[model samples]
Target: MYAYDTITEAVSDLKKRGYTKDFNIRENRLACDQLDTHFGHEDFEIIEVYRFEGPSDPADEAIVYAIEAPSGALGILVNGYGMYADENNSEFLQQLHERVRLKS
Candidate 1:
């Protein structure tokens, strides 16, 4: 429920507050490259989401997610909002299509 002006600021503050996991988009799930672990939707829950838009270009659209795993692991997922994230050919991403919709 917090408003962040930039992705970097949101990420930095969230990490400081314990959302420390760095989750990368994988073909079918989220991966913590540092921990050598893969997380399915069932393994974690979305705690908060932040959406941002460019003052001019549409390409600047993005979203940030605060997430927590059942095992007490925490993380963030920074994703694009425009065609970049839309064209991802991943089943897991497709499943989240409705939930992460961005407003123009």
Candidate 2:
């Protein structure tokens, strides 16, 4: 795994590594409008997780996830964590996190 100084740095490097799509966190799935596709928890796996902490403000906290779908689609999911996180997306992502943990 690589250490990234910022979310932009991690995303840029991952894109270079072929995680080229952008995924949006939906209520129940990850959506990529560019591909006109959406994925459920079973459809994709989290390849990498990079978390960032704010120096002074909690709102700056974020996580960048490298995700790959079973169909070979590669993408990135950038989300804010903690109290400010979206309820639906947070629950959705937590299930994914658990899956990855169990797989490891």
Candidate 3:
């Protein structure tokens, strides 16, 4: 794992490494607006996870996920954690994380 000072820096470096597409949690799946496609938890893999916590504000807590689909699609998902996180999104990500852990 790479060390990053901020979420912006992490995202920038990831994009440079080809994680371009941006993904959002859409119910139980990941949605890429640029591709107008939705992917199930089993459809993609989380390559890396970068977490950032605010020095002052708890709401600033965020997580960046480097994801890759089976079809060779690479993307990133930026989601909030802690108190500001969405319930369904958190649960969905948890499922993906479990899958990755099992594979490991």
Candidate 4:
């Protein structure tokens, strides 16, 4: 899990890495354009873009993404959710790494 000071920072980092702003409609939903120009790009098929939601705590809620690798492995996670200091950051990167390192 990447610790970001704010959601914008995370979004910016992804955008810089070739992720484009694809869509935004729902209050908590944001869709990013595909990273691949053609089929079978990175073995990791980027899926839906989502923002986290909770009943009471907005901070607890985080933005999430769904990713699927070419090998049929599935994981729904990203690099922007967790605690800033140390004790709260979720292992989102670990989840992402699991999918990213798949054998395409």
Candidate 5:
């Protein structure tokens, strides 16, 4: 898991990579919202954003987002992630990977 100095930096990196605030906010809210949700306000403590090579499917070749909810210590997975390589997805990811801390 990667760590960000600030959530804003993470969000900015995502935005630069063609992700919008609406998308992130929506995903976060959906994953962490709702009183009885698995990732409610009492689960985990970290919200992580990263990318993986994905499986053999086209849809599978996407970025993956994982959030540590604040409720049940659950690790919520948000799939179907995308980014604009022309922008700075790689750079951002590299920087984040190099700069941000990680959970053991």
Candidate 6:
């Protein structure tokens, strides 16, 4: 695995490499704002992941996941970790995190 100094840098470079869509965490699925699409855990696959820390603040901790959907759509999911994380869909989030962490 490689390292990225910052999420912005990773995002810019990933976009250049074809991770163009942005996936947001929804209650029970991932949503691509640009494509207006929703995907459940079974509907997509993780291609890459880039984790980042605040250096001093835990609030800055986040993970960028390169994702691919069944329709051949590619995207990125940016999720924060630790305290202050959204838990309304904790189960789905945990599964996604575990899958990538374990696979990667």
- Tens-digit lDDT string for candidate 6 (1-104): 55789999889888888889889988779888788889887689898898888978998899889989888888888888888578887988988878876895
**Candidate 5 global CA lDDT score:** 0.40
lDDT of each: 0.78, 0.86, 0.87, 0.43, 0.40, 0.85
Each model's Cα RMSD: 3.3, 1.5, 1.8, 11.1, 12.8, 1.3
Instruction: Identify the candidate with maximal TM-score.
Output: 6
Candidates ranked by TM-score: 6, 2, 3, 1, 5, 4
Can you tell me which runs of candidate 2 are displaced by over 4 Å? none
Task: Return the candidate ranking by lDDT, descending.
Answer: 3, 2, 6, 1, 4, 5
Residue lDDT tens for model 3, 1-104? 89999999999999999999999998878999888899988888889888899999998899898999777889999888888988867778788768757866
Tens digit of per-residue lDDT, candidate 2, span 28-66: 788999789898887888889898999989898988989
Residues 33-82 of candidate 5: C-alpha lDDT, one tens digit per residue: 33344332223443555554434544443343444443333333333434
Better of 2 and 6 by TM-score: 6
Candidate no. 2 TM-score? 0.88
Where model 1 places Cα greater than 4 Å from the true spot, the runs are: 97-104
Runs in model 4 with CA error above 4 Å?
A: 23-44, 47-60, 66-104
| Clashes found in each candidate (C-alpha, N, C closer than 3 A) | 0, 0, 0, 4, 8, 0
- Which parts of model 5 are misplaced by more than 4 Å? 1-28, 32-35, 38-44, 47-50, 54-57, 83-104
| Candidate with more favorable, higher TM-score: 3 or 5 | 3
TM-scores for the candidates: 0.82, 0.88, 0.87, 0.31, 0.31, 0.90
Model 3 ranges off by over 4 Å: 100-104
For model 1, how does the per-residue alpha-carbon lDDT over 7-87 read when each residue is reduced to its tens digit? Answer: 889999999999998987776788887678887755777888888898988787888888877777888988886766755
Deviation (Å) of 31 in candidate 5: 3.2
Q: Point out the worst 10-residue segment of candidate 1 by lDDT.
A: 95-104
